[model samples]
Target: MTANSQMVTIKGTRDGLTLRLNDQCSFDSILEELYDKLSVNGVDDGQPMIRVTIQLGKRYLTMDQKEMLKRIIREKQKLVVEHIESDVITKEEAFAWKENSEITPIVRTIRSGQLIEVKGDLLLLGDVNPGGKVIATGNIFIIGHLRGIAHAGFDGNEEAVISASYMKPNQLRIAGQLSRAPDQDAEGVYIECGFIDKQDDAIRISPLQDVLKQKPDLVSFERRMLNG
Candidate 1:
């Protein structure tokens, strides 16, 4: 019910937030505005508040287009697409697709000067040496050492996570918050994760095992044998 550029209407639903896109505006612009709005709209800390349902009243959307829309909202806004009340897809089917969504994986060592960017979740199979960098819109999992820079939730999504077997990164960023690694002896380091805390508006790091206690599915790192 707004102008062409900002035609996306947002409302709260019983399940989560619901959005209605203006048919007159192009989907691309509508989605961009959606991302901007979610970033501005605050989410209560320590709550699973990012699930969203989209209502495309009377609009005929193709399966591909619908999936693209869902992915955009999920990755850019760090929300889950629980439903899309459109002409084509069923509610049950949509939820199942989300569960079956496959994350993108980069199976290689990130050496100096190398940069990798991923749309959804990213899986790094090897070490991130000095001068290397990795950016992802979703969670970033490093099966080996992370000595360089790694940014999870490259977009404005705050619930993203960054975890590694040996978390010794030079710099770490999640969404908009940034922080540097502490000067700790390498031997003292263990599996660690970086995330935005609900209690405070700051980025914090803790033992990955401790993180797993609360959010078990947050990190899924399959350890790989490393050389000294």
Candidate 2:
């Protein structure tokens, strides 16, 4: 019914209080309404501290504005700001997300001492010789032997995977987890995939066929073959 009420809606939940700020109103207006509401609903010194979650729907706030909002909530003393949520993101963030979601393809043999890095999923058509290293923010798929090191999800994406035709990498890493390949008498005949097990957070190596069961999302048949 009141302007302040329309500007900021406060609701109580089992966890704490949720503050839904009207995105349509100006930030200054919202701040004024918030201050008034906090002042009117004075808290008693004996009362327990209340956790507050602020939701800004479709509203983007700068770093200074976010800090100001947090400071205002903290000054209330009785209200502890748990976190702030927003549907809007900066252009840089959006670009990074898009870049990280893409798949990069390369055709070259990574020799010893060579390091290849990619922001997104990597599709390599050549072998990784001993002492060679490859890193990617997403998944890594190698059509050739991986004898050195392959680090997928280099930016801490645990869901990333590494698959190679010859699964004899010296070291394999998925996010923060790392595993060393055991001594093998011969190279692998079939492609092998490595991923982090969700249960124990350990790296596991399995046949590429098992990847269909483990990570069904990675399997796709969208590409069609063309006869010349």
Candidate 3:
């Protein structure tokens, strides 16, 4: 007979083991079950340690829960343990962290003549007023309207890109490439500009006639300094 604490189903597979827990069961109980189960099956069947996948319900786990899981893993394996979700930062928090990444997002508005420099990608959720400037070593993104100057890939990342909700700008620069906004079509309701292949290295800024392009390959930004 199983312990009367909580209900947990364990299924052994060729690859590893999967543990499914009921919503009614607390995570502590599930941890107890895991410790019990793994204790019986030590990593010595000419077989490696059984990889365990916990099935957490719809509830969002707290940091404490995540720490507990990490502790368990570290105990089983004497080596350093790393968790996948530990580095996942939201777009807002990411702005402070992206100076060292291949790409980063600022996610904040910039006032006029404000000189902002980033080592990686930059993202802004609000508008960038005239005279304000944004420079990055990587890509740049303005989710809202952009009226100031924006420079991306400052470190010579030619593949970098710059995007904005309303893409009208006084000037745009990417790597060594630069372009100015055209006289006509100054305000037709849409605007976008980015580097395209071929001889069109110009910063193409125009009203977006079609749906705004989506960027999925964007990577997370890392911080150079740590704050408590």
Candidate 4:
């Protein structure tokens, strides 16, 4: 009836016992609290230990205490099987979504030879110099400068975009097409430097002023792209 460590709550169920641990606490504390609950219940002498399973959000973690603790640390992982079929999404399902999902806004610039792989839209505040590469499955945004190279739609997403404050990059790739910086404009926001047409395979760099006049909503790129 009583919770231990004021961090985990233990309750007796009709089948056995249930232990609910806070998400912020480490796995070690959870295990120690669980063991204490077992000792207090006095189920070791004659009675069997409760058939315990951990429920984290929507997924159920069913394993021995030791293995369960290990899995708890890496709870964000998803597992996939080619043949197995089931209706209910297990921790394996949540894990799959996490693995396949896109990461958002890269706040820092990648150094030389550093490879950054993100799932969702990515944004960089600093510059990406030569030899640095950024590969994102979704849109790529740069606030400062871009001089190295960046690849968007890495996983074959065609509707991806690459934007930067200073768009003088050595190379850029979107979906299946690639482009380099033009020998022209060097000031102001450049939003028209991507592969425009599906065919003919050409990269065009245009001024954002003309596009802004036509589509006013699209001009608010920062408000829409950045989550916070």
Winning candidate number (TM-score): 2
> lDDT tens string, model 3, 1-228?
455444566566665555555556677776787677656655644654445665555434677876786577557643233322322455655864443464444666788868889776676778888888988877777778778898887777776777777776778887888876666654554446465334565556533333134333443222321220
- TM-score of decoy 4: 0.48
- Over the full model, what C-alpha lDDT does candidate 2 score relative to the true structure? 0.87
TM-score of each: 0.54, 0.70, 0.45, 0.48
What's the CA error at residue 29 for candidate 1, in Å? Answer: 27
lDDT winner, 2 or 3: 2
C-alpha lDDT of residue 12 in model 4: 56
> What is the per-residue lDDT of model 1 for residues 7-41, given as tens digits with 9 covering 90 to 100?
78888766678888777767778777877876787
Q: Which order, best to worst by lDDT? A: 2, 1, 3, 4
Local distance difference test values of all predictions, in order: 0.78, 0.87, 0.63, 0.61
Runs in model 2 lying further than 4 Å from the true structure = 2-20, 29-55, 70-85, 182-188, 208-228
Worst 10 residues of 3 by lDDT: 219-228
Between prediction 3 and prediction 4, the one with superior lDDT is 3
Which is better, 2 or 4, measured by lDDT? Answer: 2
Model 2: per-residue Cα lDDT over 26-46, one tens digit each? 999989988888878878899
| Candidate number of the best lDDT | 2
RMSD from true fold, candidate 1 = 12.2
